[model samples]
Target: MKKYILLIFLAAGITMTISCRKYPVDEKGLLITDNTTCYMSSFNLLGSDNQTVLVTIPTFANGLIDTVKGTVTATAKFGTNITKVKPYCSLGANDMLVDPFMGQWTDFTQPKTFTLISGTRKIKKVYTITVTVQQ
Candidate 1:
């Protein structure tokens, strides 16, 4: 009877291990299993001085871009002026994210805010972007 009980416990442990599988998650902490798609895959600023300016887009451990702190900062070169700033972003399938300063022509005048909407779940994520001119 003891041998049989031991065998049963081993079998149960194997079953539990098999059942506990890890699923993919996005930066928003949303499970990527099924059709739950909510994240920014790509983000960038165009027409900026690529040589002298630095742009950084934060991301999550799961490789999803961080929407909450989706701040992208650009610093101009010495004596260089930032004439215009344009934002380009790519979201998940059916997911929608908008940048209030998108496609707007400016001289990096002020801070910009962005919002992202999840496709089916209707989740919203906000981000702030800023640009600075350094002499």
Candidate 2:
């Protein structure tokens, strides 16, 4: 009986070990192609004024190498009041721009400059810029 029990335990352990094989991580990560559709979730804003900005981040033709485009719309509320807000994008680290590419804002129907505000005032205000890469 002990021999049979030991054999059963050994079989189970070998099965489990084979099933739990570790998958190797790809060296270059997942591949992105022209047919791939990338989706972006909404950004949450926290401050004296509560706001939520949602946008569909555009996908690139070549995944992070090609041009990308998308739209951004923001809604803000202070206390019991609700209002529409406008956001801007800058050409820096927070929102970096690659060379030879152009990013434009088309949702608000205007071209606005990205401004740095004091404290968290600008935190609740968000905008989206459609990016286009050109040769």
Best by TM-score: 1
Off by over 4 Å in 2: 6-10, 28-38, 44-71, 74-135
- Please provide, for model 2 over 1-135, each residue's C-alpha lDDT reduced to its tens digit, 9 standing for 90 to 100: 999999999999999999997544323342222222232223222222433333232223223212223333333332312223333323212222222222321232232223222121222122243222121
Which residue pairs clash in candidate 2?
none
Tens-place lDDT per residue, model 1, 1-135, is 999999999999999998997766667675544445556666555565443233354334433355455655545445544566555666666435454635555556677667765544456667665666665
Q: lDDT at 98 for candidate 2? A: 22
Error of 2 at 58 (Å): 14
The backbone clash count of each candidate, in order, is: 0, 0
Model 1 RMSD in angstroms: 9.6
**CA lDDT, candidate 1, residue 1:** 100
> Which candidate's lDDT is highest?
1
Per-model TM-score on C-alpha atoms: 0.48, 0.24
